[model samples]
Target: MSRHRQRQRERGQAAVEYAGVIALLLFVALAAIQLGVAAYAAQQAGTAARAGARAASMPDGDGQAGLAADAAVSSWLTPKTQSGSCGDQITVSVTIDIPQVLPIFDFGSARRSVTMPCD
Candidate 1:
């Protein structure tokens, strides 16, 4: 009887250890997903900035550069873009808000700048 009771007590030990490891694994997975989201947002910002810069660099693109940049990114993401020209070079800057999977936390904005010679 004594040996049987000792084996029964050990049964719960595996469950406890599994619970601890599972919690850690969940946290790591969530963190990795959040990182992927941030990287995607950054890439989108860079694409939008380059698109805007290319548009503004054209002879007739100044009037529609903002539209071109907005169309290049995800519809859910709101991007703020600015264009500036100095001599023959044009610069476009884009800032996009990173969407949060966890509502209580903010990952902030991803910003990108691109410059090209005016055509």
Candidate 2:
């Protein structure tokens, strides 16, 4: 009877341990996913900024250059947050919104700046 009771107790112990391991695995997976998203967003922002700066570097009126830069960045970044300047040298700043996976925590926004000489 005593041995049987011990075996029954051990059965539930395995289940508890398994649940803990599974929970830990899930936490790690979520963290990895968040990191991947952040890296992707940052890369997109950098690409967008570079494209915008290149466009703005063209030899033309500042208004046209600005418009071109805005259009170039719009494909990858939100229009409301995209900013840049055009002159002897062109500079572009891009900010991208980070997707929210958790309600109580925020990963914040990703920003990138790029500069290029006018052609």
Worst 10 residues of 2 by lDDT: 74-83
- What shift in Å separates residue 25 of candidate 1 from its native position after superposition? 1.0
What stretches of model 2 exceed 4 Å from their correct place? 60-81, 102-105
- Largest TM-score belongs to which candidate? 1
Instruction: Give the clashing pairs for model 2.
Output: none
lDDT of each residue in 1-119, candidate 2, tens digit only: 69989897788787899999999998778877878877877777777677666666776534453355456543544522344455567667777787655554477888888778767
Off by over 4 Å in 1: 85-87, 103-106
lDDT of 1 by residue, 1-119 (tens): 69999998798898899999999998888778888988999999999998999988888877555787899999988889988764598888999989887665588999999989987
